[model samples]
Target: MIDLMGYADRVWTGQEDLRPYFSGALREDGLLPVADGVWMWAATGNVYVFRTAGGLLLFDTGDRHTSRALHTAVRAVTQDPLHIAVFSHGHVDHVLGMDPFDQEAAERGLPRPEVIAHRHVPRRFERYVLTAGYNSAVNGRQFRAPGLKWPTVYRQPDTLYDQQLDLREADTQVLLRHGMGETDDATMAWLPDRRILCCGDFYAWNAPNAGNPQKVQRFVAEWSQALHWMAGLGAELLLPGHGVPIAGAERIRQTLLSSAALLDHLQQSVLELMNGGLTLDEVLHRVRVPAEMLSKPYLRPTYDEPEFIVRNLWRRYGGWYDGDPAALRPAPRAELAAEVAELAGGPQALARRALLLAKDGDLRLAGHLAEFAALAAAPGSAEHAEAHQARAQVMESLAADSPSFMAKSIYGWAASQSQAASRGEEPGKEEAGWAP
Candidate 1:
């Protein structure tokens, strides 16, 4: 086959570079005061704690690894018992930091905090359990970190809501509104008295991750709609799940509006192209996020690239079929690769051609050609080694120059794989900072 086994293996490794992104991974671990009583602790994902007359209301619990850090950070500000907790979504990063709180409650002879979430969260947790191994493997590849494991132990929501739930922790009003965006079980908490909105993974200061290629289908239209509604709220302080707190009503308004504009523009462009009978590839090439929009700091493609989003959009409206007849019932990739290699004068010749293409700065196409050459050649043959070595160079080059942390991780892993294969290693399957 065109051998994704090697590529996947390459991707499941440690990331080589560290750069700032929306997620709180690269940021220093600490709690920052967002408002009078609301504090955000930066970790893998942000955990926000609000002081209420009843106790403390937490918007998200950091990942399982950060349980101690989260607990310590929150306790530093207030010793108030946690009376309420909410999961922004069901993603492992946003859902697992409650164990320390559970332990603390037992030690002090107090009841555990009541956890709240959208009704679909328990179902999302079920899916994670069912596909734990698969999710672990795919995420390892997706993040280029083989050590990362998906957590199986999840605290089910004691309070689940369908549409909206209003709670009163003393005089402060906590409004949990269900919105489908990055995940099906997303709840954005709105504090009317404070005029602060806690947007969970909705606007994490990056291009909205509505088109993660490796993840499940995202809710694009609904996400845009949610942003629009939030924008109209005229929130004075915005506390996103992963980023730093954003203050000032005008800034919040502009930020949310711009984010909405970008998503709406991308979705509409893809839909229009599809309606015009253009194939998926044709649409990908033709559709472009407006230059001004992309130029905005928040709209940069640092995580989910626009191209992947285009593919997701196609899947959403037109189904998986890409309108390419050749893709339907396609021959095994190995057969096609063998035929192509033969026509190119065997694998060595194909390797030489790929090297030339990469030298000419056509690394993307060179990667494909090099893959074909390596896969077509007999395993452990000199031809395969040479082809893989050349492919490794091309991938490393791409990774070095890429802007997005996501792209860099994937490309770097692929490069590592190719290099390993060149050394005759077996080809097999494999595996951020905060702001507001």
Candidate 2:
């Protein structure tokens, strides 16, 4: 097994890069020791196992794809029946890995492990089932996996808590607290004796995922507050849902506090602009996180960017109008594009100008023009093909410039669509290079 602690030390001390951890490239396939009796199985999401005198305690199961492998890995380490399984939240990735564990218990004639989660978890699961198709479509686009299917079935928690719940198995005690962060049903598990904290997606080694564009509203203010609370816990070992484990009380505190500060800064800045009567577009352009904060390895924009967080804050505090009358009741995009194309002389002129802007490093503006050109041109015509080719190139540039995985996936997907259009082929049939 890789020396995870040594690697974490290197990463924390700035001797190693954090990209490998964020990308799960550094994660081992088997269970890795975390604390004295605690082992963590890292996949897209992490499954933390604590072997206690009573049996075993688990926090967050891996996703559907890795559930069986996770089960095998855990069993390899210990055949102890699972005592209690905690669902950190209702996200599919964190709650679907209990099947094999359940089967194991049955085989051993052990009682099914009790499942626990925040009270809102069931509601979130219900919402997922109701909007399965929509979730699948958005996730497909966001992850650059076309036609991806969202799972509708969910494992319901046997026990629910509104604020907090304490589970004691032998000498091990876990304090579960409900916190609003990436999801309303988020549960942070704290082991007071060992000073180990199992924070769900709340502190994934990236900029807090509080502003996912393709998802529902994330509570930025509440998320920041939760981080500040976790920072005060004096945790010595921090096992996150997504990245490598972090050790050292001071390092954990600094990481939590710094993440909180970033969220707090973005939340306050966006609110200030919203109160100042600025449009969403204006707020998006004006408000920015300090370069130094983003430069931090743990705070880098690997998944979600600060701009999306600003938008989430705006969406939370203000109406959807965005202070733009034109957008309040907008005309069809194609109509507007046709009008713009006419004013620009033609779709070909718009496409040519878009390519020039892209070459000049103005990809943001170029993307809009290229899209408009493609939309304005007659479908299947030579002009349409040319416009789509321009759009593909501009979108590729945009994707290349973005550091956030979410942004890159979206831009890359758009580029693929435009590339297909330019070649007179069906759009969305070819996945992007980054697609899993």
- For this target, which candidate reaches the highest lDDT against the unseen true structure? 2
lDDT of each: 0.80, 0.88
Model 2 off-target regions past 4 Å? 19-29, 429-436
- Cα lDDT tens digits for candidate 2, 138-247: 78888777778899888889999999988887988899999998889999999998899999999988899988998998998889888988999999999999888899
What TM-score does each of the candidates earn? 0.91, 0.96
Give lDDT tens digits, candidate 1, residues 129-229.
89887787677767777656677878988989999999888978989999998888899999998898999999887788888877888888899989999
Residue 328 of model 2 has an lDDT of: 86
Stretches off by above 4 angstroms in model 1 are: 1-29, 427-436
Worst 10 residues of 2 by lDDT: 427-436
What's the CA RMSD for each of the models?
Answer: 8.7, 2.6
lDDT of 2 at 198: 91
The lDDT, on a scale of 0 to 1, for candidate 1 is 0.80
